[model samples]
Target chain A: MKIIVSLFTFLICQLYTLAQVNQASMYGLDTSFLNYNTCELGAIHEYFSYHAKYPESTMSLLKRVQDSVVSHPIALSKNGFITFRFTVNCQGKASHFKLYLLDENYAETIFDKTLVLFLYDFIKGLNGWKIIKDKSGQHILNYNSYFSFQIKDGKIISVAP
Target chain B: MVKLYLWLLSLCLFCFNNSNASAQEVVVSKIDCLDSKWQESAEQGLFHAQYATGYMSEEWQSHCDSLLHICPNFSYIWEMKAMPHIKGGIYDFASLNKAVSINPNRQLPYRAFMKCIFSKDYYGALLDLDSAEQLVHGGGIMDHSFSFYKGISYLSIGKADSAVLYLQKDVAEQSKRMGLGNEHYNSLFYLGLAHLYAQQTKQAERYLLASIKAYSKFPEPNYYLGILYLQKNERLKAKTYFQMAQSALNNGYNMNEDNNIYVDYPFQISAVEIEQVLKE
Candidate 1:
């Protein structure tokens, strides 16, 4: 019994150490929860600092959106602004690809599919995120991102970085 | 429980060693433009394999033998390089500038503009917005403002006349396209306010009333209409408009309502701006 316990303890420690292995940064997200409540969702969304060191530019993410709006001008959709939150685990794996949120009274429609596809494909095609770890260097964090779009009357007027 | 814990621990140890050995590192190898691959991808067209690289795209005879993983393109590589510091869906200024410098056609500035707007960095957004405008013109010319952002950015920067020029164009074009939709009402409403701030009361009143006609539930036009009546010393009319404004604010719902664009745009009215007159 003692030997087994000792072995188990050793295994646990080994596992913990592995989780701490430093990873080179990469583009990913932390989608730990599937049905997050509103408050939880808001908090998760706010977790990322708007401006941080070595920051990413929005150019690659939002250009096509701005172009669409300019090419075909419309207004805000019935849903107001549709926000899609993509979460990836620290291992550079996609945890949640299509987590979408919308205004209080809006209904989902076919156009939303297009929006989701664009975002998913864009994210999947992206490469070269270095690595992510907490201050303690513990491999216990996930990266997150939220992209929002405002479409109305079949017009995609605005998209956010 | 003991076995499971032990298994987890062993797995963790193995994983730790594995990660150390397989850690992705930036390849700082040099590229020789004289190489055939380099000329083909980097010079011929903006091909992915030529100018960009990642640790994963490690080709033995990589472009100029840089040992660099060929990237999708310069734009993607630049964006990926700047991805470390990003949070909250907003981009930092430095990275934004870099992205634009590398690829003028990419949407870096516009992304920065949208980020700035959310972060309430109006001045920063103006700079990005202008960059976006310039880039668009570089490739193709647009007769209208960059889809209301120019006008909104101007208004946020407190340049009402400049805003009026853009907003007026948006209001006219958008109104024609949507036929009094919420967006149309919103443009009209802002144009009216822009006129009001510029002290063009007549223009302000006309647009404000027009905005109100287009969207009855929108509280802004009513609130501003009240201010307009008060400016004319029509106390009874002003008082009526104010009551209507208040009623609109308390009302059930108009999914398409307009409010201030900054601090409280298309949502909540600025009590401070309106209260000054109410105090009278």
Candidate 2:
């Protein structure tokens, strides 16, 4: 059984600034701009590499997530990755699904609508992203999360943070 | 007379046995939040439960005994045990050294933040608070306090802009945490002071006055209000606020009731500054 190491580390810095500066005009993340959650990037991958589920309390849930990843089989090229970015609204429901197929350097590549549908459906199925609202209580601040997959042949080999 | 003496002796013996039976009953009772379960739990090696009970108890000796019974090698216990000392304004580095050695994720940042503040390491305090914030799972009292201290530490280091940034965020977060109508008076007061230091007079006045309006008995806001009016060249209004601050000198800035430790940081220093201004 392949172990899927997921960091679930979605950088929310863009939301941190835009939430305060211009809440009304903010949108989902773009690949062009840099992500600040990069601080834990290297350590997170290495930490999860050997250690799968952690902190004891969330072990069952994480174990279940990893189990599901292995169960679902996906077709892919020799190398590259598939990514899905979504906006988890103030209610914690994942929405506004945006799919991306990228090369090793992370440049976006075009994919068929069916492949996009497959990724979107999977990301929309996720249930645990934390939602935080602005102080005014009138608007919902959006936090971004990603579900990234490393593909080998017709199955998933590993997962990105 | 001999018969009466013998009867009295028998009654005394009966009463002694009755009290001993009562003590036995107390010993066998189920331990909960009340009574002296902490010592028992500690002796049983229930370390986490012992830590929790010691944390909430009034008797320090029993708590200290419980702390001692634990294996001091785990820094989490040392950190938990150190809470009372830190709260009472006494800093003990032995326990802190043990804690710093382990650097346990959950409790370390919170205690280390206190340690940094004790050492007057404002920048270090900021970094510890950031680490605590990232690792903290929920919106607990520590999270709110970290937000408050983040601002205060920046202000202490004379970084008014950065101070204002965190203080504003803290006030907003506190207000939300306290519910819609409730406001964090001391936090708002500091936010106003931060704004004043940052040269944003209008926002300063708004927040300071809001704090005074929230709790008129609080002296810091009144004293700072005086400073605010003085900046505007309104001597009479400044004098009014200064007198108000003087009257409330004994009424120190209230301590945060919601945090783990009972800490007090009054704004009495402002009184000296006001006096100097008045004399000039």
Candidate 3:
């Protein structure tokens, strides 16, 4: 009788462990849910610092403007990534900005007109960047960047490296 | 007394067995739901695969490849694969044609419609849409996606009246069924285009704005906004929208190429026809 009882308890514990394993493997734990605070602005600043060292020639300026837009400025408190592409003309005028948020949770919650407008204004302000002309002599700049952010304890954290 | 005890023991064993079976059934059901979740994840992966750059990490590619291997006839996976090809300026007529051929009775018509649109063969696309409509009618395979594409195809062929009719119907029904996703936004977009083509600028503006509201990330609304601005002689605004469209297209957004839709008006464009346009 004692052995039987011990065996039953062992079976129950085994089943519980199996259930947990299934749950963990099935729905990935949200790592961004953990508390971690880091600022994306530091990385952005570093990028710009290195970029600023490039010659202010037409091509270099065009690249600088493109880099600025691609480096996402805003961070969210979730595992999210955004990509933006834009062009700065030969005269250092930013135009044709496109931003896309690829995070499902962020898309549902954070992407809104207010945020989009803010991003647009930010890009437009960098109108002083240089541009490179294509073979057709059309001055255009293009780039893409990925940024992830998380918020913990009511404070925003940048988790993108 | 021994006989009575044996009977009681049998009864208890029977009841215990039944309860255990019920518990097992519940466990099975939970397992099924878990399996369904995996399938959903696979579907999402396929959807994103369409926009994946050619330089996909080995891990991501293997994950998607495993899903495709398990569900070879999954039409969405094939469709997703076709998209990156189109975006990267690689035309895979064979894969797209196969996708439609394999699932003619399914949502393959939508894929066929996209192929025809990308190729700038509006007439061919309309024919495919007609076939798709027939299949739906034959067996009651009612999906708002078909009507959405149908409307766009009509608009591309310069059939503004038909476009409006189909898209308005789609919008009404989709809204009722709460089908407001990418397809819903598209229906709204083509409806706006139909209005613009019909010279109803006020109505066009309303629908276009509604489309933008529905899915701001969609480039179609912004593209039409540019056109609307051009019509109103707001060149600067128009230029901004056009630039937005161009940027969106380059960054993995699929553009409908029916009727040679171009970021810059009067300039012919196709997903893979960028090289030709650039040359010109």
Candidate 4:
């Protein structure tokens, strides 16, 4: 009887330990955290690689446009990331680009019109190519690229490589 | 004399029990009668008032009064009041806020959000939508409804891309579960709008047509079709679509009004733009 009671107690302790481990794993995940990590890494790689290869020629137009426009500073902790999805049209122009996963402040506070217009101008200067049919019968090169960005403290920290 | 007193006491007990039972039966009967009458009168007055003044009748006001007298905190009475305000185009943030305060757990927020949209307060509507979404987070029918409104709110704010994300999410997650019908129609309509705003013209046309096919009586698809035609520079076709939209609204087939419901950009293209397109 003593041995049987000891075995039962052992089994209960094991179950309790297993439950704790499971709960701990789940506690690490949330909608915001997961989105931040995935989007941040992807955007950093893409933006860094593109900026390196093309250098001044490709992004100069975007810089000019950004300078022309009035922009508010966006601040975020460097600890997290967000995933964005956007369309780059045939002209290497970004259209319909948006941050799908955003921090609460970015999502709720950023005006939609300001975001879209900024994206439109920035994307227009990207150096990429998408084939779209023009008024002529032949396909022509367009600068349409859609991708994500990892932004931290008003800086492009990372992009999809 | 002691025996006589005992007999009198027993007689009194018997009479008291009989009277109490009779009184209980009478109370039950009166309650049942009151319940049925109140419901019928309230429903009738609500319907008539909605039809006559584009609002609820003060005459039907008696039904609500009667109901409140009996059950002061009834949620349905407040909902009935909301219907008229919504229909009469007088639904404001204050009225809806009052309704929500009265019954936080009920579907008052949903109704109130609609009124907010009608009143052209997209920001207020979105705040209500956010609360409603949180309230119904477990992906039920109400969740689907809330998501649809959320998508609409995004669209109104000119975040077509965001609108598409939410609308498509609703379609993928909720529409399939709910099956193909009214919910499906609503999903398609919003999805079509998303595509249109994204400049996916062909896809927008297809989805909008499908929405109209799903519900022939719905006016939203027709209105959007007009916008689509305008985009394509097909002036005559756009005019026809606009006329169809107007006719549908006039015939009372349109469910939601308040033209600003879908207004997104700060500088909306004037109705004159439509007329100019038609003239061309």
Candidate 3: where are CA atoms >4 Å away? A1-161, B1-87, B137-144, B179-183, B212-280
Q: In model 4, how well does chain A match by TM-score? A: 0.32
Interface RMSD of 3: 17.6
Model 2's CAPRI class is: incorrect
Model 1 Cα lDDT, one tens digit per residue, B137-248: 5221122246456676677556889988877877766657666554466677878888887789999998888888877877778888898888899988997877777667
- Candidate 1 error regions (>4 Å): A1-161, B1-91, B106-109, B137-147, B175-183, B252-263, B266-279
Interface RMSD of each: 13.9, 24.0, 17.6, 19.5
lDDT of 1 by residue, A42-136 (tens): 22212233221112234223444556445443343454444555554444444464443333222223334445455455555555333455568
For model 3, name the residue pairs that clash: A62-A130, A77-A150, A77-A151
> Could you give candidate 4's per-residue lDDT for residues A1-161 as a string of tens digits?
99999999999787532201111122221212223222111111122112222222212322344454445543333322233333333334343333333332222122233443344445445654333443574643222122323344444433321
Whichever of 3 and 4 has more TM-score, that candidate is 4
Candidate 2 matches the true fold with a TM-score of: 0.46
lDDT of 3 by residue, B1-280 (tens): 4344333333333333355556444333432222445446556544454356232233334433343444556555565555433322223334455567767766456554443343333455567677877777622122345566667667755688888887787787766777555445656777888889888898888888887777665666777777888889887887776666656666745433332211111122222232222233
| Model 3 alpha-carbon miss at residue A7, Å | 72
Q: Output the chain A TM-score of model 1.
A: 0.45
Clashing pairs in 2: none
Model 2 misplacement above 4 A: A1-161, B1-40, B43-70, B73-76, B80-90, B100-105, B116-119, B137-143, B178-181, B251-271
TM-score of chain A of each: 0.45, 0.46, 0.34, 0.32
Top-lDDT structure, candidate number: 2
Candidate 2 DockQ score?
A: 0.01
Q: Would you list the C-alpha lDDT of every candidate in the order shown?
A: 0.49, 0.51, 0.46, 0.48
Between 1 and 3, whose TM-score is larger?
Answer: 1
**TM-score, every prediction:** 0.42, 0.46, 0.36, 0.42
Tell how far residue B15 is off in model 3, in angstroms: 52
Better of 2 and 4 by lDDT: 2
Task: Please rank every candidate by lDDT, starting with the best.
Answer: 2, 1, 4, 3
